[model samples]
Target: MTTVPRSLDEIIASADALADRFEAYEPADADRDSVDPTTALWLAASRRAAAERDLAAAVVEARRAGVPWKVVGELVGTSGEAARQRYGRHAAR
Candidate 1:
């Protein structure tokens, strides 16, 4: 069977689903099987890192397009100073 590639959001969602499943799981044979929580945690970390990178790239693009830090902050749901503090250096490059 051919497998389709999943987007970052989809991957994150799948990871969340797996976490929920694992959380509710009970092993019928404890000597034979186990559920690993680290997989979900790693997936969550990967998703967070990917999102941060994408946000930085968008910030750079917005700065290049002459978008104000205040506007960027509004779009990102933060104060202008906070947004600038977080992304100004990346946007500079």
Candidate 2:
């Protein structure tokens, strides 16, 4: 969609209005120490990574302990060959 560009006067007026609003703004309880979206996402990603690593370690243990890929596949909701294809290399380790 093409936007009609604002005139210089309109732009200045909008900027001045924003500046005035910013200058007049006061902090409320809701604005203090709220959850930051970026930080929250970073924390969630970190947790997900840690969980993935833990799952891999457990899979390696199961593989080494002679757990069949059929059992693993049932638990993980995939085919036995699929599970083997994904994690069979770790079996020797």
Candidate 3:
């Protein structure tokens, strides 16, 4: 939850935690039969927020290790410029 993780290990740990939390919820058969739209929306939004946070943390770790933007972009399936534009400012702060 800090601006950036202090190390690659820390980033990985945080990501794992987020993923675990995101996956922890599962509706029972009865609950699934009558799903609450608000609850469903909250779950979806929470997962997305966790994913975005994890990605930003990973980007910071990569940049700290001197990984080039091109490599980062390739890994994430984006152009170097696009990746930088999206994550660079956050890393800078």
Q: Using TM-score, give the best candidate's number.
A: 3
Report how far off residue 58 is in candidate 2 (Å).
0.6
Q: Model 2, range 1-93, lDDT digits (tens) per residue?
A: 844449998788778988999999999998776879998899899999998687777788988788888998887789889988877776656
Of candidates 2 and 1, the better by TM-score: 1
Q: Best to worst by lDDT, what's the order? A: 1, 3, 2
Candidate 1 local lDDT, 1-93, one digit each (tens): 834438988788878988999999876797345447897689789999999999999999999999999999999999989999999999999
Report the error of model 2 at residue 38, Å: 1.0
Write down the lDDT of every candidate, Cα atoms only. 0.90, 0.82, 0.90
User: Tens digits of per-residue lDDT for model 3 on 1-93?
Assistant: 466778999999989988998899787799767769998899899999999999999999999999999998998899998999999986776
Clashing pairs in model 3, backbone N/Cα/C closer than 3 A = none
Which residue runs of candidate 1 sit more than 4 Å off their true CA positions?
1-35
- Count clashes in each candidate, considering only residues at least 3 apart in sequence or on different chains: 0, 0, 0
Q: Following a full C-alpha superposition, what root-mean-square deviation does model 3 have from the true structure?
A: 15.9
lDDT of 3: 0.90
